[model samples]
Target: LAAGCRTERATSVCLLRVFSVCVCHPEEKKSVPSDEPFRVVFRNFQRTLARPVLLGQGEAGAARGTLQVSRHQDHPEVCVYVDASSTLPFVPPKTCAFLGPLFPPLFSPIASFLPSESHGVVLILDGIIQCTERDEFAYQEMISFLPLCCHPNPQRVLIVGGGDDGVAREVAKHPAVLEVHQVEIDERVVELSKQYLPFMACGFESPKLKLTIGDGFEYMKQHEGAFDVIITDSSDPIGPAESLFRESYFELVKRALKPNGIICSQGGSFWLDAGHVRETLDYCRKHFPRVTYGLAAVPSYPTGQIGFFIASLNPETEFREPARQFEDAEIDQLGLRYYTTDVHRAAFTLPRFAAKALNP
Candidate 1:
């Protein structure tokens, strides 16, 4: 038996053979074996020796383990999990191709055209918008129309944090929404979404839509008691979005709405981020007269559960069922793949734990 090793990249694999070493050249060398069964191993791009096996190999190629990898469109440095199958398409665990770094981080905007783990591909018209997690349209629809539908007659609406134009598209659907003003902090998110994600931003070109590039909190403070419905379509409480989740922001939202106005804001997920949801709910209860927790199942989001906090200045709000009637009609007409009348009702159904946290 002859022992020889081959190095590829930074790792080397050993191929066992009986009576080998027929040719040995540094640049071009071929291992020759004299009539004997041998083993060959391919160099793995990533180290999988210690990584947890989601699935592992079994007897007789029993199809137990799998690995798959794809480049994330938004952030390329990050690798994404494409699929894991025992047969072909062996995907590496926890590797996503993130396309975000391909362009300049400050101004480069990327829109996901193919629906991945996050939002459906939509074009960003003005500012930089990126879907970190969750289905973009599911959350966008609720943020746009929830407060719009809650009010008896919503004429002027303001949306904060949805620069990707998905919320703007939904807000333009209602005839009663005479004017929809969207203030986004980043202009690249909107411009990128418009170029790449057209379907997700369906009606953003409407005449009633007004795009403003500014800080949403400062913008709201300047326009007190101006909007009939104020929708905060912000991201999770991290990075630049931390301020949006605070009591100060909620107070601004309250001040920006009319006397009997309704404000619905994205409050994170009730399933996984319960503590954050509870904190936001409690903040709303203190600031607004009517505070209700609603849920929406967005497949793109983790845990498949999303939530919204509806706060009304007037406790006597007439929460009307959607005039379009989501129950009996085909959900496609509503431009939704997740939200339904059942979901709408169930989202408001709080478990004892969450209810106690909010009410207490």
Candidate 2:
């Protein structure tokens, strides 16, 4: 409201560029305590487009004023709707825009009630990247790499639901990985990241990589026991991703890997989504012989914390070693901004509360 103006349907830079925004009107909701700011949202329900500038957030309401910015929208100035009674609170219109073209009603109001961190950015420490710190690549790295390294030789790896390509890029680093099959349900996420996040999306260009645009569940059902290591890098348990956290899906994952096969998947935040994390761990324990919960610090993710579950049939194999290629001098030569061995080792370290919630 400061310098940026909102329009009804006309597209604007900040509106059409990203997905959603979180604005707090603390006093609007009676349930909110006096000390808490009222959380509101401005959602953009349109096609995902890349632009130089995404959002222009500022202080509008004067009473205990709070200013927050969502990730980014691709369209021009558009209507910013409000919905206060939500688990995550604010959801922009085109959050799952990639799925929109295929399933038009995927973002219905009922579906909007669930929590999803993928469509928009969670505001942390004044809009810095620390939002993902809680769930770092450290924990994700352990869950992803440890299993792949345990195998005598891992050549074919399959990753389901890792649209961000972060997990794909990490898996491709293993020299034993001669080929990678990354199956994602949404293609816009891949295409958008290709424009927005270059480093993370670099995995899409690897010669060893084969990208598939389809349902990962169906993909797994068809390719039973075909992978040395299979990783599920999916969003939190909400919308279409909830099935990824279920026992049925883990059952499929169990069958998707070779005898010595291993599987790893994001279990949500150990702090905010601790209950969900425990449920996932419990489900994984039922399907796999070895189930371990690991933590990471991704600055962009909420609460500076994230968890991953590793399921393997091998009980004799150690769980902490890095893959050989990860240690190779030549492979190590690549300029990495986030992942490291010490970081990888430390990612498994969880706070007492988190440990108790997931393991207890």
Candidate 3:
């Protein structure tokens, strides 16, 4: 068989031939024999091998496996092939596409065990890596504690879209936090995390938690001026999470926050997409008087880093110095692996390039 062929910003649909998968514009077609296996290659996407399967043959087809093809408006077509007979409960996709706009094509959540030294498990939603056990604390602690520490009295806290419960687990560690409210749209993510990743799912068991399986937007609307700190632990701006990045969502979040309320969201990576990070921060600034960006290092996330957009209703709120400081013993007691009083201040100190792009 011939080696794989590459395409340069080809058309939308990818054709599956017998021996070789052809990726080309709609008007351009190629003929190949039907015997050997082949691979499909796109310029900006990963290469994947395509296996032959009968289109429709009743039980025979069912036994063969399932093929899923989807595309975002700004992305190339993504094809995921799942083997029906695999022993693993959830299989990771071979490749993931670039981040797309909100409400883009949807992909099922997949959890897979890593064979690395850490023996960590990773959560992937919509073909993007959500978190990995080895470095999840970096994100969870930063997103949860950044705003909590910034607020003088974070008595009541609301978590949006943290179905895995990592954020809830971190938020519960705050001493002043009395009530914890969380709303996750998909219960399956919670269920899967509970069964596969109990370390994170244990957040659901916090005595102060009130878990609600519903839309966060509506949940916030019903509870106006309720929370002192609101953390949006959502996935990338795609699928159901698209709205969370818009100005309208910030307006709703602002309405739901009590006076002097603070919010921290999972902002996109400045290294990967500085423009997108700036755009999201700009939307947040529309409703917030004080807004700043903070960074964290997570090995599994895209670009090996992620950021948070922290904002406050009070104009005098300081993102650099934490209003609440934790001693070494207190940090240890809180089980904080990534966040500290010094780290909290350092997170806001961006590199020259990033500061110019995100702040300037």
Candidate 4:
């Protein structure tokens, strides 16, 4: 039995013959015959380990368990949470190819993309979550669908930030959308997302989509009254996105939107940062006549929720009921994981505490 290990860049790739060495659960030890020719592949990641590696399958095709790796060296070294008693056939999990690191932790979010082990593909910019693949549906579906659905015919849409996630794809899902122009600050996020997170990268391939590698603030400053719907998928109300939550930015957003336009933005969490939500809405409400808030359950977000600050030029436009309704069948056809007509309306019906904090 022979073994070889190679280190490249920030990753370690170990190749071990079936007979000699393998990492797995200690209790379920299965001795490997010295003659088998199968080779097992193991990879270690620096910066972050975005995918899980499953192991311990014998010739009998029986499953043993799974292994999860993390970039946080301070955390547990090995944690296997998969059911061990179930005797199911061996099935390889979805293979998430490691593209590279996600944003530069200490600096800007200009790096590679990698799928998270538990939380789908994850983007951590400045140590804050930009998006979590598994839970992003809640934010993507709501942020993209809410304002677009509110408009009678949202043909031209503008997406600010959220280059690495599926926000553009969600906007393009609407049949009425003629063009989707996305202005993302970091091109590396888009490039890496397209390579590692294919599910979120679908929007980049759309014929109606035009991606602009630039700043959303500058993009809005240059364009005015051109969009029917504007969705701000910016990160937390800090760092590069701190200005996005300011009244001056909304002033630009108001100018960029059509007369009857609507805008929706990532408005922080009510339970975690109610003050941030209130302050953002205060800024948005000054530019638009009608303004409100909405929320979606995303476990990755603080307090198991993510909020959206919604505003409309027309006071008659209610953020509750959508202008365009979709049947369950149509939703299925569009492959929408979340954001239904009911969910859109119900998302605004917040708890009393949130209602007082945001609305008051």
Top candidate by lDDT: 3
> What is the TM-score of candidate 1?
0.65
Ranking by TM-score: 3, 4, 1, 2
Which pairs, if any, clash in model 4?
Answer: 50-115
TM-score for each model:
0.65, 0.65, 0.73, 0.70
- Each prediction's Cα lDDT score? 0.57, 0.55, 0.69, 0.67
What's the residue-level lDDT of 83 in candidate 4?
30
- Cα deviation at 82, candidate 2, in Å, is 14
Off by over 4 Å in 2: 1-143, 322-331
- TM-score pick, better of 1 and 3: 3
Q: For candidate 3, which ten residues in a row score worst on lDDT? A: 50-59
lDDT of 1 by residue, 268-332 (tens): 66544466777887888888877787766654343455678888888776443543344445556
Q: Candidate 4 at residue 242, lDDT?
A: 80
Q: What is candidate 3's CA lDDT for residue 258?
A: 98
The alpha-carbon RMSD values of the candidates against the true structure, listed in the order shown, are 13.0, 11.1, 9.3, 11.9
lDDT tens digits by residue: candidate 3, 159-219: 9988889999999999999999999887766776787678899998999999999889999
Model 4 lDDT on a 0 to 1 scale: 0.67
Candidate 3: lDDT of 134?
73
Task: Write one digit per residue (lDDT tens) for candidate 4, span 9-68.
Answer: 222322222223333232445322223234333333221222222111221122344322
The true-versus-predicted C-alpha distance at residue 316 of model 1, in Å, is 1.1
Q: Can you tell me which runs of candidate 4 are displaced by over 4 Å?
A: 1-118
Give the best candidate by TM-score: 3
Instruction: Output the TM-score of candidate 2.
Output: 0.65
